[model samples]
Target: MTLEHKRPRLEIEYCTQCRWLPRATWMAQELLTTFEKELGEVARVPGTGGVFEVRLDGEGVWSRKSDAAFTDAAELKRLVRDRIAPDRTLGHSER
Candidate 1:
């Protein structure tokens, strides 16, 4: 007998860009695919949405990187709990 399970993961890809983005987008996809395959713990959860930006200037390179956090409702609440909860009192205005 056999069993299977799925783990959530970050899925970075070359989304649409302006008409002038370099060809590195395709190469970036290929390179990410190859690297992720070798690095097993890097999950590829489709639609586990996050934000990214890319600027390409060469066939095999990219620049202008940016990424933002991703969190569900529960996670978001937890992150802000210390800020909002009176008992925690680690608010941003703390000295």
Candidate 2:
């Protein structure tokens, strides 16, 4: 019998005190729409003290505080796609 590999899970942790839920939700929606089949799940985690991070399988992929900027939708898509589906084309998002 062949074993099936599990898809990657995305976690977006945003600061609740900073009111970043809308941002996190937007990012989650974008990721879900872009990688609906490639991703196993997308989770929104509540945080504090200006924390905004994205992780795949518990590994940090992007951090707003560290980067000093919010991650763009296309950039985040590329980052996630590279890890989950390296060969997959992102069409207009490539630019």
Candidate 3:
């Protein structure tokens, strides 16, 4: 199998009622673009109650409620990179 099959999947769960689809999709796009070869897929999940969480292979990496803030693009990249491609450098994102 190719690396694509072996790569981890990233999921962004956002509250539809909160109108967070744009934010979720933006995060997904950033991840997919950064880790084009390291990720199996990026999915957007709809939820309610102001939910905004990022999951890697079914495990939570970032949460809005508990984390108390939305993960910025750089932080999100670092979180995902640590899980799926630990050794991969993220250039300016690392700074």
Candidate 1 lDDT over 1-95, as tens digits, reads 12233322222333233222222344334434433432223222122122232211112111224324322323322333332232543333243
Per-residue accuracy of model 3 over 15-85 as CA lDDT, tens digit each: 99999999999999999999999888999999999999999989999999887777799998998888878
Alpha-carbon TM-score of each model against the true structure = 0.21, 0.94, 0.92
Local accuracy of candidate 2 as per-residue lDDT tens digits, 28-52: 9999999999888999999999999
Consecutive 10-residue window with the lowest summed lDDT within model 2: 1-10
Model 2 regions lying over 4 Å from their true place: 1-3
All models, RMSD in angstroms: 14.5, 1.8, 1.8
Q: In candidate 1, list every pair of residues with a backbone clash.
A: none
Cα RMSD of predicted structure 1: 14.5
Q: Which ten residues in a row have the lowest lDDT in candidate 3?
A: 1-10
Candidate 3 deviant stretches above 4 angstroms: 2-5
TM-score of 3: 0.92
